[model samples]
Every structure is written in structure tokens, then in C-alpha cells.
Target: MFTGIVEATGEVTALDLRGGDVRLRIRANSLDLSKIQLGDSIATNGVCLTVASLLEDGYESDVSSETLSVTSVSSWHIGTKVNLERALTIDTRLGGHLVLGHVDGIGEVVHLNPDARSWCLRICAPNELAKYIAQKGSITVDGTSLTVNKVEGAEFELNIVPHTLEHTGIGSYQAGSLVNLEVDVIARYVERLLLGDSAANT
Candidate 1:
């Protein structure tokens, strides 16, 4: 599990797709890898990948075929900047909402404009996933947790502050960019519990 808080930005040093699978190598800039061991999980661009090997400055992980089909990881190229976050520990702070590092669906940036002191980004979520998103709700975009500023059908808006822009890869986003998106975990469960009836009807 993760808190969806990006610790650092990592660069894709290598991406090799071979024989029905993929090998991803990332150079985690300013990210501490000293305590990271093989088999530890790392959240890269909202995808939870296991650390297959330890590198001098980063690590390597294998992206299975399933992950490729469901996520935007397949489109990642060398030099791509990705949000990086370590797995949550028992003692870690819940600075952001609980995130499983599981990409429910991919979204496309439809609009990006500057707000007063921040950027307003509007993304089109997949039809199936859009119903789960709500205004003022939490969503993880490319591994960075953020609040939804507004929601209109399949499109949701976000206010990206300078700090968020600088700390994560969101700063590099533009119109038509594909991003890994994970909806709030709590919302999913709530919907399941109230699948057939409203909360008041319960």
C-alpha cells in the first residue's frame, strides 16, 4: 500500500519490451534506495512494481503483460520523468489518502490552463471510472495524490499548485498527455457497500 505521496521524480533510464514482458529501469533522482531491497514494492507513475534488482542509483522491475495492457506504462520511453514513492510503513504518515498503487484506468488530459497561482488541469477519465470520481474527492494522478476541484461527467478538474507541479511529474503535463489514474480507495468500497441501495435506505 502507499499514500500516493511522491517522494521524488525518477527518470526512465531504460525500457525494454522483450518476449511478451517488459523490463523497466529507472534512475530515481534524489530518492533513497539504500534501504530498498529486492522484492520491495515501489510506486512509479501510480503502478505498483516490485523491485527486481538494485541499481547504483535506482532499481529495475519487470512489467507484466497485464500491467502493460491496463496502464500507460507501455507508452513510457527513455528519459520519461515519473513520480516515485516508496511503499508505506506502519509508522509512515498518511499525508495523502490510502492508495493501492493500482491503476484503475488511464486518463487523458483534455485541458490545461493557468489559474491565479496554480494550474487548472482537466482530464477525461474512462467511462467506467468516471462514476467513481466526485468533486472534492481524492485521486492519484501518475502517483501523485491530488484533490478533485470539480467533476463534469467524464471530465474532472484539478488545481495544481506550484509545489505539486515542482515535486511531481505533473509539471510536465500538457494537453493530450496520457496519465495513469487511480481513484480513491474508500470511494470504491463505499460504492460496493451501497451498490443496490442508497445510504439513507440502508
Candidate 2:
């Protein structure tokens, strides 16, 4: 599990295609790598990837065919900047909401405009995932947790502060950019529980 707090920004150094899967190599810019080990989980752009191999300054993981089909990873290219966050430990502070590093769906940037010092970003989410989002609720976009400023049907708005713009890849977003999105974990559980015994079939 993760807290959706980006520790650093990493760059995709290489992408090796192997049969149906692709091996992803990322170079950490500021994320500490000393504590990481083989099999450790790292949230990369909202996708939980196992550290298949450790590198001198980064790591490599295999992106399964299924993952590529469901995420923006298929569009990732060399030099792509990704949000990086190590898996949270018990002592870690929960500055953001609980995130599973599971991309529930992909969203598209519909609009981006400056709001004084901050930037207002509007994204159009998949219709199926719309019910999971709410105004003022937490949403993880490319692994960075952000609050929803407003919700209109399948589209939601967010206020991105200058700090976020400088630290994460969100600042580079433009219209039509695809992003990995993970809704709040708690909301998914609550919805399942509300389904009562009927949830078992699902």
C-alpha cells in the first residue's frame, strides 16, 4: 500500500520489450534507493510495480501485458517523468489518503488553466469510474494524491498548487494527455460493503 505522496520524480531510461511483456527501467532523481530491495514495491505513476532488479541509481520491473492494456504505461516512452513513492511502512505518515497503487482507470486531460498561483486541471474519467469520485474527495493521478475541487458527470476538477507543479509531473500535463488514476481505496470498500451479500458474486 501507499499514501499517494510522491517522494521524487524519476525518468524512464529504457523500455525493453520481451514477448508479451515489457521491462521498464527508471532512474531516480531524488528518491532514496538504499532502503529498496528486490521484490520491494514502488508506486510508479500510480501503478504498483515490483522491483525486479535493482540498478545503480534506479530499478527495473516488468510490465505485464494486462497492465499495459489497462494503464497509460503503454504510452510511456524514454525520458518520461514518473512520480515515485516507496511503499509505506507502519511509521510512515499518512499525509495523503490510502492508495493501493492500482490504476482503476485512465483519465484524459481536458483542460488546464492557471488559477492565480495555482493551476486548475480538469480531467475526464471513464464513465464506469465516475461513481467512485466525489467532490472534495481524494483522487490519485499519476501517483500524486489530489483533492477534487468539483465534479460534473464524468469530469472532475483539481487545484494544483505551485509546489506540486514543481515537484511532480502534473505541471507538464496538457490537453489530451493520458494519466493513470486510482480512486480512494476506502470508497471502493464502502461501496462493496453496501452491496451486502450480493457482493460475493462480484
Candidate 3:
């Protein structure tokens, strides 16, 4: 599990699609290597990936073909910046929400407005996912936890502060760019329960 709090921004160094999985390599900083070991879980762009190998300044992981077919991690190109966060520990605080690091779907940036101090980003998501995203609710974009400023039809808005723009990759996003999106897990459970009841009649 993860809190969705981004610890560092890592750039893609290698991306090789193996037989049934993709080998991903990224270089990072601000995360201690000594504290990490093989088989450790790391959140990369909102996806929980186990560390297959460790290095002095980077690590590598393999994403199964199933994950690649359903998630946006497979669409990333080399040199792309990705949000990185270590798995939540028992002693760690829930700075954000309880994120499973499981991406539900992919969204696209529809608009980006740079303001005096912050930025207003609007992203378009699927109807099924948009229903769970409410105003003031928490959403994880490429592993960086953010609050929904406004919930509009299929497109929601975000107020990105300067700190976030500098710390994560939200600042480099352009119109029509694809991003990994994860909705709140609690909302998903609620939807599932309600849907199950509605389906009982048929």
C-alpha cells in the first residue's frame, strides 16, 4: 500500500518490452538505497511495482503484460518523468489518502492555465471514473496526490501550486497529454456495492 505522497521524481532510463512483461528502469534521488532491497514495493506513476533489482542510484522492475494492457505505464517513453514513492510503512503517516498504487484508468490533460502563483489544470477522464471524483476529493495523478478543485462532467480541475509544479511532473504536461489517474479507493468500493445491489434485480 501507499499514501500517494510523491517522494521524488525519476526519469525513465530504459523501457524494454520482454516476452510477457516490460522491463522499466528509472534513475532517482532523495531515496536512500540502503533502505531499499530486492522485492521491495515502489509506487511508480500510481502503479505498485516490485523492485526486481536495485542499484546505487536507480532500480528496475518488470510490469506484467496484464498490467501493460490495462495501465498507462506502458505508454511512457524514455526520458519521461514519473512520480516515485516508497511503500507505506507501519510507522508512516497517511499524509494523503490510502492509495493502493493501483491505477484505475488513464486521463488526458484537456487544458492548462499558468497563473501568477499557481496553475489550473483540467483533465478529462472516463464517465465511470469521473463519477467517483468529487469536488474536494483526493485523486492521484501519476503517483502525485492532488485534490480536485472542481468536478465537472467528464473533466475535472486542479489547482497546482508552484511547489507541486517544481517537485513533480505536473508542470510539464501539455494539452492532450495522457496521464495515469487513480480515483479514491473508498469511492470505488461504494460504487461496487451500489452496483451490485442494482444488478440483483436482473
Query: 92 in model 3: Cα distance from truth in Å?
Result: 0.9
Tell me the spans in candidate 3 whose CA falls farther than 4 Å from its real position: 195-202
Question: Who wins the lDDT comparison?
Answer: 2
lDDT of 1 at 167: 94
Model 2 segments beyond 4 Å from truth? none
- As a TM-score, model 2 comes out at 0.98
Q: In angstroms, how far off is 194's CA in candidate 1? A: 2.4
Q: For residues 1-202, what per-residue lDDT tens digits would candidate 2 score against the true structure?
A: 9998899999999999999999999998889999999999999999999999999999999999999999999999999999999999999999999999989999999999999999999999999999999999999999999999999999999999999999999999999999999999889889999999989998
lDDT of 2 at 28: 84
Q: Judged by lDDT against the true structure, how good is candidate 3?
A: 0.87
Tens digits of lDDT, candidate 3, 20-44? 7899998877765678889999898
lDDT of 1 by residue, 1-202 (tens): 9998899999999988789899999999899998899999999999999999999999999999999999999899999999999999899999999999989999999988999989999999999998889999999999989999999999999999999988999988989999999999888887878766665565
Q: After superposition, how far is residue 108 of candidate 1 from its true place, in Å?
A: 0.2
Q: For candidate 2, what is the lDDT?
A: 0.96
Better candidate number, 2 or 3, judged by lDDT: 2
RMSD in angstroms, all models? 3.1, 0.7, 1.8
